[model samples]
Structures are given as structure tokens and as C-alpha cells.
Target chain A: MRNLLAAILFACAAWPAQAQLSIEITGAGGQRIAIAVAPLAGEGALLDGANASISAIVRADLERSGLFRGLEVPRLVPQLTEASSVNYAEWRSRLADTLVLGSVAARPDGRFEVRFRLYDVVRQVALGGVAYTLTREQVRATAHRIADYVYEKLTGEKGVFSTRIAYVVKRGERFELQVADADGANEQAMLVSAEPIISPAWSPDGRRLAYVSFQNKKPIVYVQDIEVPKQQIVANFKGSNSAPAWSPDGRRLALVLTRDGNSQIYLINPDGSNLQRLTRSSGIDTEPFFSPDGQWLFFTSDRGGSPQIYRMPAAGGDAQRVTFEGSYNVSPRVSPDGKNLAFIMRDGSRFQAALLDLNTRQVQVLTDSDLDESPSFAPNGRQILLATIIAGRGVLTSVSADGRVKQRLTVSAADVREPAWGPLNK
Target chain B: MRALWIVLIASALAACATTQTPDTQPPAGVEDRAPGATRPAPGTQSVPSTPVTGVDLSAGRPASDAGNPLRDPASILSQRSVYYDFDKYDIGDEFKPVIEAHAKYLREHGVVKMLIQGNTDERGSREYNIALGQRRAEGVKRMLLLLGAREEQVEAVSLGEEKPKETGHDEEAWARNRRSDMLYPGEY
Candidate 1:
């Protein structure tokens, strides 16, 4: 029976020499569908130490999408974290929409091989799989890519599992700009500073980070290379220099400057050469982000007697008010898709996360936490990484793109703030 | 520009409903909606729009439709969610009555521009949350449209977990944090 089953599975793996397999996920009606991923299994190779960790990360990403339910029961039929034997009836009883089973094995030559398949339980058939060769470092990413593919197939939207997040972790009074995997793993301090670090913005290509640091005790804006670990002053104006935002093409930086006395909006080249002031407001003007199309610059201003969101052309034009329903609105981060603007709106006594549509300009409050600030968008613009005060300490938090799945992120013992979530870094 | 100024004033009044909390307050959806009943019937009374005349705020329009302006807006915040679990954008069954009442008022009124700020607790990444918040706001907007809220009158936004009303470090706070708020002209 075992030999016959093995032959059947082997035939299935090579069934069609060039099978054009594709997987698609629909039926999201705002629901987190349950899924079960069996551990990986393959021939002539075996997973060494820590392969289990990689599978766990992939599972966490899917379950956290808040769009898929993952089975994590111990007594559950032995599921492969990669390719596994058939246990269809067991999972079907548990209401699983999809089953992900794959295998990873180590070759004697110190290389790795991976094979995987995604099955739609509702359809009761295979959708997609991969039989490929790779290195150890590439295995986790390949697994993540597979997870992304399966998630997108099921949710009808792109998956952001392969993205990254950049935030400042205060280590013993020193502020460090750190970049890590989207799950806060693989953390590496990108920049270190003695003073406060306010804002961290990402280039469109995820190659560089622009942020405002008080390294010299005075607020200074800097754009640092994410790859080479080099830094340059982007805005070190005479007065206040804070809230650095990168333009879409990564050529310019928009920030809050008080050089003219009262805080106003200013634009500068990434190399810190061309400094052009945008808003001439007598009140406060700060926290500017460019629209995805590079046509408009959205920022916070108090010219209307209270801080609210206003927009102006990137090429210097009269400003148009975008958020008129909130008295205190700041920290405007435009979505990558250019459909909405997320910012801090203080309505009456509520200082919370709120969003505004570009076309309709409607404002909806997204949070109820007190003193929520410094919001950054994910690469897909389907989620946001923000700094919110949790347990009297500033910690990183993430919210789904659709205002579901509020997750409080726990990173270091020190405070974390001003998160700049980059697009998928290749 | 006069018509624009009036509209701006009205919008400003709507915007002014926020901005009066102590900085120490837990940042969440604590927006105090004007009491549902206190708002005078539309068209019966002229709109007391507060234009930016550089005048003292004491002369501003009354900041309440919910009776007492002295009452905290946080006290009136919706204790229940408008969305289903694992769903970022949609009015759940629990909040239907609340949304229905609000929608009923919008149906009676003409094109009144309001911002539906979509929000989520700290869950996913910021960018995705903003989009989710936008989706959540759009979900509410779609519901209102279905219930007679004009499409032109509703705008959507996402503020992914930048604020929260319940500041605890547990599941309950997260629940309160994932929400979308309704914005109006006068009440902050």
C-alpha cells in the first residue's frame, strides 16, 4: 500500500511536464478564512535546523492578514509545514478554505530544494505548486512568495508578506533607525543617533530612508541610504527641521520647516540642494507627503485656526484644504494607490487615527487610542505601521488596510516611534 | 469665493468638532458626536457656520447637537464596533441600529459632506492599515449610500492605528481601536 501510494504521488508530481498551474482566492466578504499548512516534505533532501521557524513565519503572515484562519492545533493530523500526506477529511471538517503543504530538503552539496502545493478545499483540487532549487537564505523568501501567491489567490488582493518595516528603537538613550522583516525579524539598526528621531520616510524604490533626527540637539532632517548605511543632511534649516517625507520618484523631500519663524511647509531635493517653500501659513505647517502620482503635496497646517490637512501642487501652487472636518489634523500620509490620506485627527477630545479620501475628501476616524501619531503606509498601501502609546510606552502598531485587525507590535524594551514601512525591497 | 467661504466655514465647523482633548488621553476613536436629538431640524433654522474671521472662539457656533457642550465627547463614542471580526470595512450587525439612525438623518438632509475616517487597531503594517481604513470608511459610505446617504456627500479615509480610545494592553483595547468614525460639521 505504501509503495503504491508513493508511486501515485510521484506520478502526480510529474503528471504533466509543463502544467500551467495558477491559484486564485476570492470570497473575502470581509472574512478571515481558515487555512491549514502542512509541513514541507520532499525526496533526496531533508530540512535541517530552523526550517520549522520559516514555516511558522509563513503561517503567522497568513493568519495575521486577518483574512485567513490558520489551524494551529497540536493534536491535529500531522500536517507538513511543507508537502504532506493526504488528510483532506480532517481539515474539511474544520472549515478550512485552503490547504498549503510543501517540502524543503537539504542536499549533501550544502544547497537546498523546495517543493510545495496549494489546494483549494472548496474546489478539492490542486491550484499551484513549485518544484525548484535554491540556497538556504532564499528558502524563507521563496516560502513567503509562495504564501503571498496563495493569499492573493484566496483574497483577490495582493499580499504584503514579503515587505519590510523601518522604525526607531531607543536603545539606552540613543535612537537607532532599524530595518527588519515585516514581522519585525532580521532587525538591523540602520542609523544611530543621540537625540530624538521624529519621522522616517521611505523612497519609492525602498532604497533609502528620509528622517528627522535631533542628533546635534537641534532638529535636523537626513536621508540615509538603506543599503550602504551612508547618510546626508536633507534639511538642517535655521529653525525647526522635522517631519521628512519623500516624493514619489525619490528625488525630493517635503518637510516641516520654521525658518520663516512660524512652522510652514517646505520642499527640498533629496541631495539637500533645491529648497522651495510650499505653505506660507502663519500658523503651524508640518508633516507633508506626496501623492502617488507626484502631482500634489499633502501636509498639515493651522491656517484655518486649527491644524488640518491641506494640499498644494508639488510645483508650488495655491493650497487647497482637504480635511475641513477636523480641527487638529496632522501627520498626513497618502496611500500608495493615491485614493486616500491617513493622518492624526483630533476631533473634540479625540486624538486618533483618521483617513480621508482624495476624490471625496471624507474623513473617518480609525482608532480610539489616545495620542496616536506618526503613521506610515505599507508598500501595498493595504496596511499602516504607526507609533501608538501602549502601556505608557511608545510602541509600533499595525492596522489592516481596511480598518480591521488591530495588532499592537512588540519590538524592543525601549520605545519605538516614527515607523517608515518601505515597499518590497528586492 | 463667498459661496466657497461659506462652504469652508461650514466645513471648518464640522472640522472643529475635534481638537480639545488632553494630550495624555489614550489616542483612539473618542470623537464625541453631537447628541442625535439636539441638532435642530435642517432647513428650519439657518446654518450657524463658523467662518474663520480671526475672532475669539467664544463667538463660534455652539458645539453640540447632543445637549450639553460641557459633556466629554469621549463619553459619547460608540462603545460597539461597526465592523465584523477579521473584516476591516463593513458595518456589522451590532452597529446597524446606530448606523441606521445616522443614515436616516442623512437621508432627510441634502448633500451634506462628511468624512468617514476608516481606522484599525495596530494589526498589519501602516500602509495596508491606511488602505484598510479607507476601505472601512468606504464600507460605511457604501452602506449609507444604500440607506440614502449621497455618494457625493461621503468621503473615506484610513488612519491605521495612530489613535485609540481604549488604551489597555489587551484584546479589548484592540477591539475598541478597530473602528471608523462619522464626521459631521459642528460636533467635534
Candidate 2:
């Protein structure tokens, strides 16, 4: 699996202009739907290459989702780029449930006109068709958008292809906070420092990142605008300031501050005003995360003699313990639907990612790694991205919510940690 | 900009140290037989007594006569680190004497200040480890204060798993990493 991922990364770097992430699914939750993506026809050479690149992206996206399987294209079938030209019988005979056909044309204004149609091969009918005008820079994004449409239409759930992921990477003495596509493509480092950087949390709107940096020999929380490169310290108290979690509303941050003599949870505005203490426990209180509805805050505390997850009102009140099975549970993150809680649980001496069904109160460990931490649910809540140690080095791993499918995202010689899946772009 | 201010404050502190006679409170159980045992001159501040027992200071040693106990291997203050159990921050009874020695040293030397940096093994979540490490440091600080160390003499901070005493992943390495190291200013 590692070798295959390395080959894909090498291929991507070999062709930077048309580079796309190649995902290899390590596991599947259940049966996958068979789909066929026909090679698109184009009016010019540029359009033809664009068509093939876009189709590859869409196919990769759908296949990586583990919900669809791409059917092998036969040599006899001619390339079809429109619903009118597609032979539904040919796709149906191949056991494909769905067929995607698209055409690319060069517009006079230098933009590309891309049209695509999704067909239900079983019913022999076109489900939908859409047209998009995009420039060269927007082709990749537009392809992802098209994939999102197809995925949502087929699975009846919102697609997270358009979402971004933020993570921290440490190489030698340099530390960087980076944002990239959910597939680990198009990585861009937003902040770099000689000191360690950890806990990169995204704002709800995906416009900024709040993270902890030790640039000045002490942990300080800083919120940096993702687009503008401007940064301001949101929490730099007298003592350690770390673990910045954004509220669902994006107006306030729930962070861990030791300014009051011990580690405790606090709330501060984005502009660093109106600081309010949330937990007054003598035992360490940290890793405060907000629920989807912005009503309750889930945090980790050691007040019960061991660290466990607890939930309390957002306005600070009595907190109720949530985990009992494990003596060590921390880094609680709620699913998008608020029906599940993902955290790191200690199994024997190894730490693994575990998910708790909020309704049934049943917990299931999702990872097998010996050291897993900082589990963040995807925007769609189908996968949880976490940092785990493999062969003594930190790497990012994404596991299916059901603990079946898993993917390891390695960054060569760098140690990557603290993955924060951003919200959907739209 | 912040570095400049820090330097300014440090120099200001250095200038504020007036060469007055040292405090007259002799070490515990020791008689005032030394030539410097004379009473405090007018307007001079007297040093607080070392309330801790078991120290024989009848040799007429000055309050600061220990000559930086932190560097003396035989001094309890030399044992800078206090270790704890796995995921546990509360200081064990075995480490109490170590804290007491440092507390006594702090009380005797009013000008001495130390930073208690807490650390943890690289097992749990990093941020959570940071908080746990802070509690460990604070646990030592609280013990020192309870044993008569002034509040300003100690500052507690946590390094989480960033600074590991041993890089190994086994219990031996973890045991050493899960500790609070007392560092005099500028030592780090």
C-alpha cells in the first residue's frame, strides 16, 4: 500500500500541469455501485486534453469515495460525449448501473465550455445534464463540482469532494501548517516556523485557520486568514495557550489556556475579546469542541481521576461525563449529523481512534494503529482523518466511520500531524 | 520588538539588586554564632526563617552561603526533576522530599526563581498531553508553595511531549518523560 501511494505521488509530481491524486481504497464498507465514464470528445486539442483530465479527476473522486466502482471501458465502443450519442444498452450490458458522458469545447473568450450528463443505465434514461464555463485554472474545481453532483444524485448524500483539509507537517527544525484538497493534492503551506505547530482548526466558512504555534518558545494561538496571509494572536495568555477549536458559528473560539494557573477551557472572540472561562476544574481541562447546533461544548478533562470526554452547555455550566469504558479518552469531535462522537481511546497500551454512537452510547474502535490522535470527521462525516504513528513516524490516516475502509496519507520524510478536515466549500 | 522589552526588563531587574546586607535568618536549628549574625541594620529587610527541619546550620553558614545549591549534587535542590506514574500528574510520595528541598532552598534565597516545566510521554493527544503536563507542573508548584516557597519564586509551565528525556517508546523512556523539571531562569 505504501509503495503504491509513493508511485502515485511520483506520477503526480512527474506531470505537475495535469497532476491529480490517485487514491487506493484499502477497505470498503459494503457493495459498490458500478459506473462507466466514457472518454469525452472535444472540439480542439486543448479541449481534448482538458476533457481527459477532467474525466480522470471525476473517476478518481467517485472511486475514492468507495461507493462507486468504475467499469472497464471496452475497445469496441466509440467515445460518446453527449446523452444523445450514448448507447445505454452497451453500458447496461457491461453491468454498469450508471454512465457519465461529457464534451468539451473551446469558447471564443478563451474559457472552456464543459457539458456533462448522468444517465441511469438500468432505466435507459438521462438523470440530469449540466453545462459549465470555466477557465484553465478552474477546470479542476469544476470537475470536482461535477463529481459532487453525480455523487449526491446517486448516494442521496452531500459529496465532500469540494472540501479542503488542513494539517501540520514537521520536517527537521521547520514546522508548517498546510491546506490541501481532501485527496491530499494541491498542498499549500500557510504558515511556517522554526518551532512546532499543532492543532490547525478551520473556521466554519473555511476562510481562516486557528492553530497553536511555539514561535516564541511558548504556545500561542493564532488565527490566520487563509487567503490574505494576515495573522493575529487570538490567545497569548501568561502561560501556555493551545488547542484552538472554532465554534460552529465562527465568531468565538474554544481554546485551552493555562493563564489561570492550570490548564482550563476558555472562550474568546475571533478578535480576542470578551474572554470567558468555561471549565473551573482543578484537573486539566482542554480540547474543547462545539456541537453542530452550537449549544453544547465537548471537552476532555481529568477531573474523574482519568482523562475522559465531557459535554456541557456552551455558556459554561455543569459538565456531564460521556465516556466510561476507557480510562483514557480525549480529542472529542462530533460528527456533522451530531449522531456520533469520534475520539482517541486507549486500547491496552496503544491509542486508537474510536467512534461512539450518540444514540446508542456504543463505542467502536475505528483504527488499529498503536498511536492515533486528533480525529476529525469529514464534512460529510463518512470518514475520520487522524494522526497516527507508523514505524515511529507520524502520518495521517483516514478511516471509514464504520471502522472498515482506511487510507494512509504519507508525506515522504516529513512527519504530518493534527489533521483538521475543513467544511464544504459551498 | 518583544525581545527588546524582555531585555529592558531584565536589565532593570539587574539594576534593582542593591548590595544590602543579606537576611539574618540563619538556617533551621543553627545558632547565630557567625560574625555576620548581627541583627538587621535599620531599614533593612530581614530574611524569612527556613521552617523546614533536619538541617544543621550551627556552622554559622549565611542564608545564601550554600553557594547555589542547585549545582551541588548532594543538595536536594540538585534533584531537579520529579517523576509521576503513567497519565498521572499528582506527585508521588517518593518525590515529596525532593520538592521540600527545593522549597527550602527557595525560601532561604529570596532572589532565586525557578520555572517548573512539565512534560509527558508521546502517547496521548498532544494538546491533551500539554494540559496534563501543565497539571503535573502545577502539582509540583503547589507542593512547593505549601512547603513555604513564595509564589513568585516558582513559575509553572508545560512542554507536553515536545521535550522528551528519552526518545524511546517503551515504558522506561515514558517514565523519564513523564516528569517536571525545575529550571532556574536562563537555564533553558
Candidate 3:
């Protein structure tokens, strides 16, 4: 099996297309921040015919976060810019807690410069403003950055709007690995094949993606850079090779290989050297995940007669079962803070995404859907992106950690699944 | 574009030539009397003699051998799928004869290789299902090894829940999807 023919890899040429996913929110937030995003004065001529306006993108990003409510910002005689003065009394009457003002101007070098400022309506003070000069290809990213700025200033937490997401889209016999914005916009295809592609994972630096592709007639773990054309088959051993997870430092990877009697966790370098088996289970042991602190390894195993999540030292050691309430719980994903574990727990016959509080050992089922799998936490650990079958079609959904706010992402023509939220852009 | 067509056509012709050339002798079938032309048993089990849908055996045997036991709809070797219950990998007693027949065939022919692909229904975690599917295939592989088949001649792998024969979410489709399909050489 190791000496089989190399897979016929196909790189997609069409990318940066329209947003493949349309998001629908179904819940409200507690203590919502009412923010008003006014239209940029000079953006009409520059960003005409674009998919969305700058203000609209920023407002949508903040509203979908489940922590902010977008208030209507009426048109003014003179549109607001970074240098515009805010009428505190008027905004206060409109029930706006905060205001966002911006303007887009054409730079001398043929690029566009976006300047945005945030205002604290309650305090009647002006927050700081920043400017970003970017090419035409970066209009949406600039808007997300401005939203991130406001989110960080108000919520006092890192924003995930500017981060990217990776998912798989299946249309008939074609399978495409796509990268898009966190809001499911700016879709770009990286790899396309006739076989199935699943289990997409992002590197720590957000520069490379490691996923399992079955184009070679069997599952093989392959790592490919986001912008590079070439790819490397990191694990194509004799038996199956799958479930690739990168370490925090990006030096090593924890993957499952079946070369030894059955499925077992193995650690290997990115270049496919220094292979080490970390589990000695007679039963199946797979789906290895690393903690944020890089101290423990959480994986799913059937060693206890049923599939359950287990944790052990990052280096091979004794294992301890983490879930006991439900007979079936798997796909353990540790939060960014290492305080919670997100996995799929079976409720009767329905499978749902659930979160476990590591301190109290309390498990909370996040969704009440049927056949929900692949629970992936946002980089900030606020929301989980999972795949569920809705109306007989595979759709991706984002559910808050508290199970209060929910958003469903669907494509009109294709089936999307296996979502992996990339890390925040540094 | 013309060069690409030439390459496609050349590969197509090469594929035809490879299928026509049956270098290795035909594997031991249910009937051990003939090499290429073998007769099927009259009545093996309660399974219908009709060929199973989606079980394509055209590539497994040479075109000239029309009476191949593996391709005959009435032969026990033609039944390739072993179904299982929910979350279970153990072989049922009803399917033991089918497995025994294949194991006998493998034991007789040393040059023949078999590939067992385990699959599952779409539920729960996909990676865990992959592990479950692997266990299913490994169970069949162990059974074959115990029945006198060489370990080196059998390769067991899991397709997980990726390739489902039936797409419904009901129990009928789930039962059909949770199966291990046995493929002979040149069929995979």
C-alpha cells in the first residue's frame, strides 16, 4: 500500500468567488451592545457593485457574534468619516450605545484606504481610529478588521471576524476543499477531487492545512499550504492514515494510523519522520486532539466497551476517561482556554454537539439536531462549528458555547460539511 | 486539447488491454472443478439468486470467462456484503457460510488477494465511525485468518461512513450501509 501510485492531485483555478454560505441567526444575546455602523462617505464610487457595503459587513459581523445588536443608522446630510464629529445627544435618543464611523478614499498608489473610528455614546467620548490601505482584493478583510477593532475595544476580547474557515463542499461526484471568511464569504477552493475529502485541520500559524483525502483509493493524510500549489503526503503508511491534528508549536502532528493491528494514535513530524506510537489499546483508539497548553492529549477510544473521550499525557502514558454520562461521546475538541471540551454526544438516536466543563465535569448539549458531527471550536472558544443533516442535506452550523445563539450556514446548490475554524490572524 | 484527447484515448486502450490479458490462473471458486468456467451450487442459503445491485464483478474476471463462479448470480461467492446491526461489528451466524466459502477460496489460491472495506451509517462522530469501521473490517479479517486464509493475502480497510450504498436516514438504509464489502483482486 505504501508503494501505490501517487494520487492525482487537482488544484482548483477558480477561487475568491461569491459567498457560498448564507447565514441565518435564530437567537438573541444578553446585555446586547447596540452599535450603529454608518455608511462610509466616499465608498459608493470605489466599492460599487461589490458583494456588500463596508457598513453592512461590519454590522453583520457584530450582530452574528451574539453579543451586539445592530441599530439603524440613518443617512446624514454629510456622511460620517473618521474626522466627523458625533452628536452624542442624537445617538443617545436613538438608543445607540456605540457608533462606528468610517470613510474610504483612493490612495495615490491606486489602492484604497479605509479609516474608521469608534465612539462611546454613553460616555460622550471619542475612541481611537485606525487606517488601513489595501488593494481591491482586500475590501472585505478590511471591513472585518474594522469590526475586530470595535469588538476588541468594546468586549475586551479577541475578535474572530478576521479569521478564515475551511470546509468541504460536495457536488455530485466532485469534492472541493474550500477556504472562506469566518462569516462564510470570500470562498476559495484549494483542492478538488472525485473522491471524498474530510477531517480538515488548520496549522497553528494559519498558513497550512492538513486534511485526509481518499483520492488514492484509501485515506491518506496530506498537508498543503494555503497559497502553495505543491502538497506533501505526510502519512501514507501500509494501513489507513487519518485524523491529522497539528501541535501548538507547529513542529509535530498527532494522527491515527492502523499499520499496527488496529487504529492507534501516532505522533509524527510534518515532514513525515520521527513516527512514534502513543497508544497501546487493544480496542480502536483514534481522533487525537491536543490541549491548548500542549500538556494532554484527548482522543476517542472504545477500550471501555463503548466509544468515549479519553485524556492522557501528550507523551505516551496512562489514559483517563473523560466522559461517562452518555454511552457514546467522541470527537473531543479542547477549547482555546483549555477549560472545556467540545464533542458529539448521542441523545437517544439523535447526535448533537455538546460541551463539557473540565472543572465541574458538567456536559451541556448545544444542539437538538439529528446526525450532528465534527464539533470544531472557534479560535476564541465562544462558538462551535459543526456539520448536521438538515432536510436531508448536509449543512454547517455555528452554535454558541452556551447553546443560546445559533446560526445555520447553507449553500443553495451544494452540500457543505466538515468545517474547521482557522486561528485568528496575527 | 488534441494532445489531451490522445492521452485519454491511449489510457483507455491500455485499460482495455490490461483487462484482456489474464496472466494469473483463475482463483479457486465455489466449484473447484474448472479454472475459468465453474458451475454454481444449486441452493446455498435463502438469499435470492438475483445479482445484487451495485455489486459490479465485470472488472474482477476476464471477459471470456462467462461462467465464473464469482460473477454468477447463483454462486455463494457472488454475495459480497456482510450486514451488521447498529454499532455492532460481530459476524452473525447467518453470514458464516458466506465467509467460510470466501475463506476456502482464499485458502486454495495463494496468488489471489482480497480487500475488505468496512462501512458504517452516517451518525455520531466521523472519526469514531472510522475506527468502528476499522474494527468491523478487522473482525472479518480475523475470521478469515482463522478459517485458513493467509494473513498476507487479505487487506482490511475502512471507508468509514463516507460511501453509503443507501442515502436514507431510516433504519432500512442504515442496515444496508453498515456492511463490509469484500472485493477480489482487480475489482477495487
In model 3, which regions exceed 4 Å deviation?
Answer: A1-19, B1-65
User: What lDDT score belongs to each candidate, Candidate 1 first?
Assistant: 0.63, 0.79, 0.83
TM-score for chain A in each prediction: 0.85, 0.92, 0.94
The candidate 2 chain A region of ten consecutive residues with least summed lDDT is A13-22
For residue A36, model 1's alpha carbon misses the true position, in angstroms, by 1.2
Summing lDDT over every window of 10 consecutive residues in candidate 3 chain B, give the lowest-scoring window.
B18-27
Every model's TM-score: 0.62, 0.83, 0.89
Interface RMSD of 2: 14.3
lDDT of 2 by residue, A1-426 (tens): 446444543443232222222335777658888888765566233444435477777888888887889887653345577745666787788899999888888889988888999999998888898899988777678778989999999989888898899888766545668888887778877876656788999999999999988877788999999988777999999989999988998999999898977789999998899999988987889999999999999999888988999999998899999999978999999999999999999977889999999889999988778989999999999989999888988788889888776777878767788899999986
**DockQ (C-alpha) of model 3?**
0.31
Off by over 4 Å in 2: A1-24, A43-52, A74-78, B1-69, B72-76
Error of 3 at A189 (Å): 1.2
Off by over 4 Å in 1: A1-30, A42-51, A73-90, A107-109, B1-188
Candidate 1 docking band: incorrect
In terms of lDDT, the best-performing candidate is 3
What are the DockQ scores of the candidates, in order?
A: 0.01, 0.20, 0.31
